[model samples]
Target: MYADEICRMMVWSRGTAPATHDDAEHGSDPLTREWLVTNGLGGYASGTISGAVTRRFHGLLISALPAPLGRTMMLSDLSIRVVTPDGKVYQVGGQEPWLDETSAEVIDLAEFRLEAGLPVWRYEGAGMVFERRLLLPHGQNTVHVTYTLLEGAGPVRIELQPWVNFRPHEGALDRPVAGPYALTVVEDRYELASPSDLPPLRLQVQGARAEFRIESDRLRNVRYRIEQSRGYDAVGEFYSPGRFSLELPVSGSVTLVASTEAWETINALSTEEVQRAERKRRTRLLLAAAPEVRSGPPAELIFGADQFLITPAGRVEDAARARAGGDEVRTVIAGYHWFTDWGRDTMISLEGLTLVTGRHTEAGYILRTFAHYVKHGLIPNMFPEGKNDGLYHTADATLWFFHALDRYLTYTGDRETLRFILPTLTDIVEHHTRGTRFGIGVDPKDGLVRQGEEGYQLTWMDAKVGDYVVTPRRGKAVEINALWYNALRLMERWVRESEGDAASQRHGAAADRAKASFNQRFWSEEKGYLYDLIDGEQGTDDAFRPNQIFSISLPNPVLDPARWKGIVDQVKERLWTPVGLRSLAPGHPDYKPKYFGDLRARDLAYHQGTVWGWLMGPFVDAWLKVYPADLAGARSLLAGFPPHLDEACAGSISEIFDAEPPFTPRGCVAQAWSVAEVLRAYARTARSAG
Candidate 1:
């Protein structure tokens, strides 16, 4: 049954065609459909299935370096060429220019699919077949690419040319770096060291004898079409130190190991051992999930969920501190191709990524870890890559922290962790009550939490371009107030449990006042739904957004119970899409159908009408709350994700999709909260179905 489900999750395609415009939205185009693998320490490898470098982030090794260095793109790419016994040359994987229609398809790629989150490709031509597989072992700054001659002529020579780069993962590809890249070879092991302060990148081959030829060359203007579309410097350059040539016999295989780790660490496991260990680890992860979600799309999402739960290796002190405390630092990488640990994303993703997956210890670790960073009642909005401290700019992340703690306790019953962070949690609530940074505080008269400040986008609808704050949901945003009310109630319950009734009464009273004010002030009597924001910069925003869903979706419903159906039904009619709920309703003046074009253009549409995949979690939660008997209907709402996993970042959910038809996936390819919410919702509905 597991094998059958694995086969089902596998997305495959035949032929070697350049990506068409439509292919970018769908998974059919190998050049646009990307795949990713991570090493648990924030290090990752990602590239398109067609093997072309479409984005600056497309690489074989993006090593997560210690403080100040962040994620460095060490090994950029590898050009693979196979020489047949008949002297026929074929390019299997290389820097193929996407726009070059004239480029010949030397390697006939017969198949490409992700086998249990590991990418596999098959090439067949002239009665010859070869298979390629790629994976990164857990918690190691390493990547292994193995090739096997499944059915090929004996003694066929294969050449490997590795491209080297010394830049941040988000660095401008076209920017030139001073590089006297010196190559040192000890037997088959090769190390490419640049003049930069960073460490050298190590490369080697296993299960095969290799010959190295010192042919130094620079490939210029390696165009990244995706970057160009996003209005950035698109062209890049790579330095190839040399080529490694090896001979492959029928049914013979060889593996290439690339890393920035020490030689001892690299040599700790053989290529097959690493592969076997990773496969077994993945299986164990799936088994750890709830029984109902151990197969099908949920099982595949369980794999996606693991990609974001990474150690903050860049913050070396965080690790040491955690170790000293007898705990490990675990945080969620909000999204791939470029996102660090975000407070909002992490808290939102906690239940689905950890609790449902049965990673209770890590869940506690995450909660406690964030608790260490709370400032003046606010959690850091995001920890910039390689930075020791996080930026405390968010208004609701801290509130979400309370909800995450509630979910963790509900799942594991680990009161010790609760007791440990309860003080910080109390401080957070007090801070919110009195008022904190970014003008965040509860209203004296109404008790509704209101947050807004100039030059800073506080809420989750935050999308800032230059001086402009898009969707600056300033005063008493629906979701923020809802989360605030929920947090107060949760605190009331926790305080009563730990410190007795007297301490808990304040929280209970505040929650009641907030709930009353929210129901009376925010609801649109004519529209029969909650307003997005009350007492905003302009006035009360009656813009029909999916944010109102949180009014009912949260653990504590802030909106009146009688109005739950009205809000849910309104969201269903206006904001809900197959993929997720749109940021804004279609008829709204700010509604933008598609999230595309340059940075400013995309950000404009970002919260205006873009469909956020993470919102699905809350939508589904609210759906089940409003329609408890229709578990099948809630399960069906998740049906879009299985097909979604096959596209964009294979085996993962994208950060956001287009609000319009086809809902072209935009923003980060693999999102943490996106995968988490979907997985959480799936598990809930599946259990209810049973």
Candidate 2:
């Protein structure tokens, strides 16, 4: 067999650089100082300053709608400004209207102009703003603006405002979604007299402070209270959806309370007790802890929270419906539904949404939705939500499906369900073996699968533009081969366990044959590291990339200990980042440090060199598995995760970061895989330790 013919290679020797370069770089001046703030719910605000030029900036991005009682209305207004070191004030809105793109239509919220001493910009709409001056010397000053919620006649009375602020310092910060202003909400209620029937109820508010209050005429005798904790803050007033003002400093907590008649009503049904029970239930459904971090309460949990705060009746069903919308809110709730969604996120999310969150039916529906589009043995690259077509080019989706199906079976244990999808699995394997997209067909010469083209993104380093694929590996990729190995193993297992047909025995034999062939052709003796891929010329480049991590990290290990250790050492030396693992080595010819240029430029650099937050999952998994004997070392390696988790958005993980030092969080504010992998890894390590 090919596996038996392959020879094991010795570990590569490590090199040491002079200590001068390290010490010299350590004393560089600080680049800039930026900080983040948020509302307890989901909105975020950040401030940044460029130390080089001393330019100050502030930005706010809102992610939720405001609700009064149980109704929400369109966002009406927003405003923001900054006080300069020279005592000159710069108003944010007066220059250009801030555009809100969180929804389909972009609303221009900046409208006010400066009429006096300072360049003050004001935006007036359904929301109110208050101006207050502060005393400071020429070197430093403070400017404050407040937003007041306005009342309107709408059936539903609640408004969820999404906000974020960024101050990049030297240059202008990214425009705030709306006006850069503090948000606030106040509630007012009144009743109308009736001759013989029930009285009418109403709720209203004013101000924009990322805060709201709630009051009800029906519960006039009751009062609601707000509480703050180490990392959170809130203030309550009355309108609907129970209004409240909240400030969540990173790494803090806050709680809401209802008093008097409202308390009595809530207490009558043991609403607090019910809420506690629900929280516990939801937490258990989404909880996944690794050696370092945990990510859960999943999309369904957030949806449940939305329903809890909005409508009490049919809340679970309402959450399901809301998730189906697939908008940014739904996307965020889902924690990073990639634009190109094959099964990577869809399958991983199942663990949280279906297996853990108790929404198995939704899990089945989403799987079926994707399975319906499988073509030529290939799962989709992603589904076009607005269209009816799928981009079928992914190698891992089908493989992931087997795993997801297995997980779903473990949770639901419904043989009929498993049998229903068995054909899909079989078709995928058959398609790959026969022939598929790119050159990803089985090669009889070596039994190793072949894939990719000059400018086509086949494997996951898939950053591509119009006819120009960056980081194209037109050969056999490391991870794809690992996935291939896994697929064969899964097929053999499935066939033996479920189908039990004689043909399955043939499939098992073929799988065993392929695995042996993979080891012989892919392992590099000279470099002591597995080649990332084998080119058409049969030459392998011994680059230290993350793809090889899967071979060892996965439940099925394909490489022997010597080869696995060599790859791990190489990866740790080159690809590891304090925040996460970089996509490409910093020393690569195409490496770029700056990632904030035009969209096309940034996208090209995205996977080619950017450090993805989700890669940490496999990296952590591989590290822990390889270093299983070093329990303390494994835990120590993950210690950066909790602080990184806490430092980024509150309880949320960023999508990607710059590969170089001062690795700033980039891409989406919250990512699904980042949370999923972290939570899953954390849970696995924690379970093992326990």
- Tens digit of per-residue lDDT, candidate 1, span 1-690: 332236433433444465565334334567788889998989899998778788888899999998899999988888777777777777774337432223534655667776777788887765678889888888888989898989965778988888877899999887775488888988778998988888989999998989988998887877778888788999888888888899999899988899999999999999999987887888788778888788878888888899999888867777787889999999999999899999999999999999999898999889888888888988899989888889999998998998999999898888999899989988988888899989999889899889988989998988999999988888889889999899989989989999999999999998889988888999888888888888998998888888888888898988888998877887888888888999999988889999888899989999999999999888888988889989999988877787787678988999999998888788899999999999988888976632
What is the TM-score of each predicted model, taking all chains together?
0.97, 0.58
What residue runs in model 1 are displaced by over 4 Å at the alpha carbon?
A: 1-5, 8-17, 21-27, 93-105
Number of residue pairs clashing in candidate 1, backbone atoms closer than 3 angstroms, sequence gap of 3 or more or interchain: 0
Model 2 lDDT, residue 146, Cα:
29
Best by lDDT: 1
Per-candidate Cα lDDT values, in order, are: 0.85, 0.44
Residue lDDT tens for model 2, 1-690: 111111111111112121232221111111122223222222222322110111121232222222211111111112233222233333322212232122222111232211111112222223222221111011111111223222212211222222222111111222322222222322332221122221121112222223443322111111101011111112211112333334322122222221112222323333234334434543443343111222222232232211111111112333455457441111113232113234566564555334444545555655555565578887666644223355766666566676677667766777775666678878888878887876777777766677865666766677776777766777777777777777677777777778676757866676677778778877878767777878643467566677778888765666666677777777888887766787777777777664544456766788766887667767766776677765565545445555443233323456677787677666544555665555454444554532
Candidate 2: segments with Cα more than 4 A from true spot: 1-342, 348-362, 410-412, 453-455, 536-539, 646-648
Q: Kindly give the stretch of ten consecutive residues in candidate 1 with the minimal lDDT sum.
A: 2-11
